[model samples]
Target: MVFAASPLHADTSSTAGGAIEIKNLAKRYGSVRAVDDVSLVVRPGEFLALLGPSGSGKTSILMSIAGFELPDSGSISIDGRDVTYLPANQRNLGMVFQKYTLFPHLSVRDNVAFGLKMRGVAKAERLRLAEQALATVRLEGYGDRMPAQLSGGQQQRVALARAIVYRPKVLLMDEPLSALDKNLREEMQLEIKRLQSQLGITVVFVTHDQGEALTMADRVAILSQGRIQQLDEPKALYERPRTRFVAGFIGETNFMPVEVQSLLPGGALVQLPGGANPTEVRAEGLVGNIVARGDAVGALRPEQITLADPDDPAALRAVVNGVIYGGSTVLCVAQLTDGTELRARLPDPSRVNVMAGDCVGLRWPVEALRVYGADAGAEVAAS
Candidate 1:
């Protein structure tokens, strides 16, 4: 049987939903491994986003979960019930695609009621459910309008209403806002998040947009080359990425080459190789208090770095080469003593007077430093 009771006759509003576990999943297309040995546990009622760049296998994994694409190996279970081999129609999932796939010929109300209609729900009861779903999406008055009559955001809202009108246990969205403008996309993101929290259904959203994932997902899985580089809460993922790919992908950062001097109980001390193009920096503060000399590189975020007074002894001397002023903040590019390029984010661009050819000291807290494996990169600088 399907994991959750059918929303048609069940009081799905109070349903807590079911957990999904994907184990040792693999998918291949000829010589290319599209998804390789992926495993993840999505908690009940959790919002998880599969985040990655194009061709990173995030969409492939989502398709596998939705039963649109069959995995070559491993298993998929919802609430301990195996559905790895189940057909798409039997999985009882709600889905919204990047494009609004609503029936062009159907009115908004008809589109929202279509799933319930297919389930043999009584016509009157299904229509009521459809109205409720439309209200949930704040499209109560637009139910009579055809898909083409509504704006893009309104169409997406209709799609969302249709997806949930049947009270689906899990909702899968594949870059549903990719086509919307930035402002509208962000607005829809908040709308989607609010509905997801209120509905308490398990949601798996796929997106290449890091901001979208960070803004909506309870946890994010960063995918690359058919594997997950890291999976963690948005704040944790941003603060402590476990891999270089994750650190680089999540936000702005600078990776510098350094030699590991010693690993401490909670951090590492390293020496920066002062070379024009010397690579690597060592960092710590991950899961372990201790670390061995691996393919680790020093990671420091742009915002965490600050310009220091020349008299400060704990600062790295750098010569300001370029400064680009954003609306509220400035991006300062500098050349270190070793000729390595460094970037610092200075807030209050209007107040800060940093300019090119200015010599400044850059410093950051030791705790803010992180060391991620360079295995994500093709070359490991010989330290």
Candidate 2:
């Protein structure tokens, strides 16, 4: 369903409270340091996503911002107001969780108006505001229905309407679409983005799914081991990751051992295990430090490598181990002489004819390879 932009109210100047600044926020749970010395800034009307795996401190930071969890050290401020020690209710922030968290017994309209009622808004005004919120969520005619009577997507929309009916300064979402099916989750991603744009609302979203974060967020903060590993736009995070962890976590990559030969202007020349000669990598492709005569790992994406004839002089020789068909794309798994398995993604499986055990050559552009230090490789393996 397509939804046209509509104002929640005639005057929404008060809903422009969107800037959030987090300074040295630290939270610990007994022996586990959930969040450690993390600082971030969310711009007004910007959608920022906190993305990380389990135990990566993404949720801890979101909860701390929502005033659900207090930090051991650091302060949180919204639009220049320090709210580090403020109560959750006093923060005036809208929150939506993975679960719908709807009142089953109450009508949808009442559920959306509950927050307004608690704030002592007059009955008529609160009901009118609730109806407007329901309309904003594309559920204008369903306000009289009960929560249990709605589908999962409908229930989630109701929860969202309730959160925004009060017109909070910042909206905090804790994997709100995690429980939905893949198609529904993707649909909601666009819906939420549209709503946030129409209302000019600042949103802080938490999720472990990389695709979801890339699809919905203007910028993403990737956390690992209670620290912000990298914060960049989706394209930058995928194309020019700052660390080995960020590269591996953001998308699929093949890591192969390489020997650093010499240092160049912006990057270094590295020799692959079974490569024909040393190849130059740009500075942006280099993840960690690379000293001369040192060991490092070269990261290459599957799509970057192309299949070539084994007789090609510059191509790396390998034997095809397997061929897996995946609808539009085909995966060719090949092993080099040094037993390093690399995968190459090819488009149109029908056009490619190669069997397992066949000899093939792997070739890629010079800038396609990313060099990471030996220590960084070990850290990625440990994670």
Candidate 3:
């Protein structure tokens, strides 16, 4: 007699939808290592987005998880079951890809029913499940429409309904929204987020768009060169970036080179090497804090600085170089006395009405400075 319910069986999604654990996963294509020893954990019911630039191993890692591409060496376990060798069809995963792959000949209801029918579900139950799935995607009355009869968004929803109709253990999406127009994409993002939260399923999505990752993910995994550079909440990753790549990639910043003169308990006093008059400024928690005698660079966000009159005691005197008006806010590019280029963001363009060669001053809070050591050009590892 065979016992069916074993707590420690070779199963995937063993822990209430299971926790995905990847250990030292590696994938190679002849000489190029597409995915290089990536390890990460996707917790239960969490939405994780693999974010990176093109060719950054985000898709490769997704493929590895789906068993489309076997790793050279590594262990993949969902819950506690070893799924390293399991085929893609056996993994019980719902997937949506860039293209809406719904069959043109099949009606929406038939398409959603296909998965269940293949699993040997009874006709009456499969039709009921298909109707329920269409309702889940908010297409209750249009179940009989064929793929070509619906709009792009509607077709994608049909594909989604098909994927989730069978209630898979996990959901994996690879750039599912890239093909849609901007407004539609945004709308679908909110819809998808709501659906995922409602189902309480583990979702691993891949996208190169920074804003999408920041908005949709519970935690984001920043990937480059087939490895994870940083994995954290979007706010934490933005506020306290550990690497120079994280500082530069996540948002817009102005990098200014500075040489450390002395380190203080609360902050540091540094001299801007290229600034006019070699002005010394006090900054807190910057790149050179850990280093002693060397040149470093400080990152300043555009919104962090303020423009004011040169004669003001509170402002650092500089000349307005250029201005770019952007409705709600204006981007003012100014040159310091030492010819250091700086940008300041203001709510209104009228506040700093000045032409080129006009002298001004710039001021910023002490906490906005970010210090990076000399070799801040290191690339981020993507997965």
Residue 267's C-alpha lDDT in candidate 2? 85
Candidate 3's residue-wise lDDT over 1-383, tens digit each?
00112221222222234479999988898988888888899998899999988877899988888878888989898777787878777676778888877878889898888867666677888788789878888899988888889998998888888777766657889999999999999989998898888777788999999889988999998887777888999997776665677777787777777777666666566665333333334443464234655688777788888876688765667788888888888888888667778888877676757667788777777677777775544465533
Off-target runs (Cα >4 Å) in candidate 3 are: 1-16, 273-284, 287-289, 311-316, 337-339, 349-352, 375-377, 380-383
Question: Candidate 1 or 3, higher lDDT?
Answer: 1
2 or 3, which is superior by lDDT? 2
Predicted candidate 1 versus true structure: per-residue lDDT over 1-383, tens digit per residue: 12224343523465465699999899999989888888999999999999988888899988888888999999998888798988777776888999888899999999988877776778898889889999999998887899989999999999898888767778889999999999999999999999999888899999999999999999999988888888899998899876677788998989886655566554555665353222223333543223454434677899998898745666777889999988888999988888888899989887678789988888877677765444545212111
TM-score versus the correct structure, for each prediction: 0.90, 0.94, 0.88
Give the Cα lDDT of each candidate.
0.80, 0.86, 0.76
Minimum summed lDDT over a 10-residue window in model 2 is located at 1-10
Ranking by lDDT: 2, 1, 3
Candidate 2 lDDT tens digits, 1-383: 00111222222245674799998889999999888888888999999999999999999998898888999999999888898988777676788998888988999999998877766677898899899999999999998999989999999999989888867768899999999999999999999999899888899999999999999999999998888888889999898876778878988899888999999988888898788888888887776668899988889999999999998877889999999999999999999999999999989889889989999999999889989875554323112
Q: To one decimal, what is the Cα RMSD in angstroms of model 2 from the true structure?
A: 4.3
